[model samples]
Target: MRRIAIIGCGGSGKTTIGRQLADQIGVPITHLDAVYYDDRWNRMDPDKFAALQEELVAADTWVIDGNYASTLPIRLKRADTVVFLDLPAMTCLWGIAQRGWKYRGGQHDSSGVYDRITWGFIKYVWGYRRDMAPRVRSLIAEYAQHADVRIVTSRRAARKMLTELKAAVH
Candidate 1:
């Protein structure tokens, strides 16, 4: 796939998958967190963020990763493939913990300068399937119906999908 949109709850491996896909497909990767938040974690203005995303998706090829539901339509409309990492909450929670420990005193590759893990953030991750999946699914249905949509439910499934995609591209 040329233009891909990878979406999922925090710590669901979206960045990892996006990077691998982009590298395999020979395209640039955009981590939406990098665009939305500065090194100091200040947020970009909403309108400007949307406009920037519009510009990003207008590219000939890219793999964009994020779950900013508010601006999802911008990428969804342009994506040829949509990868939704629907892994279990416990798996996602463990991911967050591992990432937090790995990047405890430094910046994340995809996220902003610091990897801050708050209680609220944990709660959000724990409840993401219940709270955010429906909206993401509806948006995908509405805007990306023409796209190749893959809902990955487990880490094993994600790996298999990546392997299959790599083989397809080769």
Candidate 2:
């Protein structure tokens, strides 16, 4: 796909899938965490973050990955494809734990934000389905009516979809 938006709750593997898909399709990938947070994990100004996203979406092709709901519509409007990783809460928590351990004392490879796994983050992952899914779904329904939406609910399914996409592209 030319323009892709990979979105989901924290620890839902958005970055993993985005990286793989972008590599397979030969497109640049932008992790919104990197755009919104600095190397020191300080927040960027809201207006600046939105402006940066605007500039990124102006490009011809890209895979933008993150769950910045406020500006989701910007990417959604320009995206030809949107992949939502709707993994279960437990699985998401597990993923977050794995990532925390792997990136302890350092930043994640996918973004400039620090890889600290806090209780708040764990709770967010735990309650994502109940708290965030509905909002995200509504946004997708409203803003991505013309986009091809793929909802994947498990890691295996995500992997299979990525493999299929790679095959199709090649």
Candidate 3:
């Protein structure tokens, strides 16, 4: 798939999958966190962020990963494929812990934003399925009905999907 949009709760492996998928498909990848936050974690202006997203999606091919629900429609409208990482909250929380240890004193590989874990962030991840999934599902249904939507519920499923995708691209 060419223009893909990967969305999920924090630590749900969106960035990892996005990177691997883009590499396998030989397309440019954009981590929305990189676009939205600077190294120091300052946020970009909302209008500018939306405009930038428009520009990124207008490209011939791209794989973007993020869950900015406010701007999700833009990417959803252009995506030919949408990968939603719906892994369990505990798994996601473990992912965050692992990621934090991996990048404890440094920035995230894809975003360049420093790794800072907070109670709020943890709560958000823990409550993501309950609080965010419904809205995300609705948006996908509304905006990406024509897209190839894949919901990955477990890490094993994610690995299988990536392996199959890589094999297909080869």
Question: How high is the CA lDDT of each candidate model?
Answer: 0.90, 0.86, 0.89
Clashing pairs in 1: none
The worst-scoring run of ten residues by lDDT in candidate 3 lies at: 105-114
State residue 84's C-alpha deviation in candidate 2, in Å: 0.5
Q: Which portions of model 3 miss their true places by more than 4 Å?
A: 110-113
When summed lDDT is taken over every stretch of 10 residues in candidate 2, the lowest stretch is 109-118
Q: lDDT value for candidate 2?
A: 0.86
Per-residue lDDT of model 1, residues 1-170, tens digit only: 89999999888999889989999989878888888888777899999999999999999899999999999999999999999998889999888888879888468754443566788988988989999999999999999999999999999999999998888788
TM-scores for every candidate against the unseen true structure: 0.95, 0.93, 0.95
* Ranking of all candidate structures by their TM-score, best first: 1, 3, 2
Clashes of each: 0, 0, 0
**lDDT, candidate 3, 69-88, per-residue tens:** 99999999999989999888
Off by over 4 Å in 1: 109-113
